[model samples]
Target: MTDSGALQKFLDGVVVDAAVFSLRPDYRAVLLPVDGLVPGPSDEASEALLQAAEASAREALAGRTVEDLPHVVAWREAYKSFGAKPQRTRNSLEALLRRAEAGLPRVNRLTDLYNAVSVLHQVPLGGEDLTGYVGAPRLVRATGAESFDTVAGGVPVVEHPDAGEVIWCDDAGVTCRRWNWRQGRRTHLTDDTTTALFIFDALEPMSDEALQTAADDLAAHLLRLGPDVRIVRRLIANDMTHPEGT
Candidate 1:
């Protein structure tokens, strides 16, 4: 990896400063490709696809959002969940993949950077748009229709009742997160993200080798973007031990 002046420091911060989250015992690690783009699964092909996706994501973002959940179900039927009900915006979080494959656009370097990584890794990522949390930044689950009001345009609703997990930021109920496979229109990444939480999700905890590669690759990618970037690892949890606990 070529060094790009202050980029080394930025790479350090992006990997070190931010916290990371893992899936709950209830959820299983599943390899989710960029939605709509992920081909049907075959054990052999799925593994290769996942690896390739991870490589791409690392190339662009030097970070990733661990993706879990297979599907959402209610009564006896299953439906797609996009963190919010009624569809907040026209953009599908999956669009990031398509965009990345086409090269990034210039809309605030950070935003483009995040999308690049999101697409490369084939994982859905979410974060603060530089405006702190409007509600709470908690990774909670969807209970029912009455529990999902953050992005419903004032419409009270519930998130996915089965499978899948979501980031239930308290600031806005469920403002910005990857629920059921798409990003919310409410809180998106913006140009002004000085301090933000970068998410990395997976069906299972990454092997140490994979983690190291992820770290190295991400750092390399960040170096290419410019400089003065900081990346640290942050873990968010509620055990009283705190996430960065001993």
Candidate 2:
């Protein structure tokens, strides 16, 4: 299938809506819609990519720390503005970079690919199962009333984000807390996930060209999952209008 065909399949089951508000004027986001995935354990080729990405990350980190990286510094400040302790709850990009400095764990094919890309590009990237989505996926300030499904003490539990927190949610509840800190269990990607939404969150110092490059890389890697895979992409910015008819 073509990229548009895969994107249409992903959009068939649910409406995906997203926006960025109350963020620094330089904040940017790229949303990639993909469908016809065959999620499963990491194959040898995928593992090789992950390994190469880790090596690249390690080499990049050799001269400086994660905090010194412009992208990570912007994210840390963004988290601080939202009342999140960056040291305690590191953003996904920071966490992944730190792990890469040591070694990256092989999760699954989908997870490994995204994680590798995130570290390599120095951007926060996430994949969520669209089939599990309740309604349109949105990025808005949390009201502290949306329920977030998570695991606590090895058991499932529900939690809520602080009022005015930056979050990604659907009609059901928070899909990700603190922009990219923690992902809810409800919409997490799994081996059965056929359609998925990938989020690439960016700030200043991360240019539009960089964002597009990351999205393109992800789309290409996703195609490795199956010949029938499809993908669609959109860029969300403070100055841009809603992505429609384009």
Best by lDDT: 2
- Report the lDDT of model 2 for residue 135: 69
Q: Mind giving the per-residue lDDT tens digits that candidate 2 earns over 3-102? A: 5765655444333233344557677788887888988987897788888889988888887888999999999999888788899999999999888866
| lDDT (CA) per prediction | 0.37, 0.82
lDDT of 1 by residue, 1-246 (tens): 122323233323321111222323322122111101111212343333334654564464435421211111120011123233422221223444434444444444444444445445443344444234453244544443313333455764445333243434443455533433444444555444444444544322333244334444444544443354444443323233233431
TM-score of 1: 0.45
Off by over 4 Å in 1: 1-107, 134-136, 144-165, 177-180, 205-208, 223-228, 235-246
Least accurate 10 contiguous residues by lDDT in model 2: 12-21
Total clashing residue pairs per candidate? 43, 1
The TM-score leader among the candidates is: 2
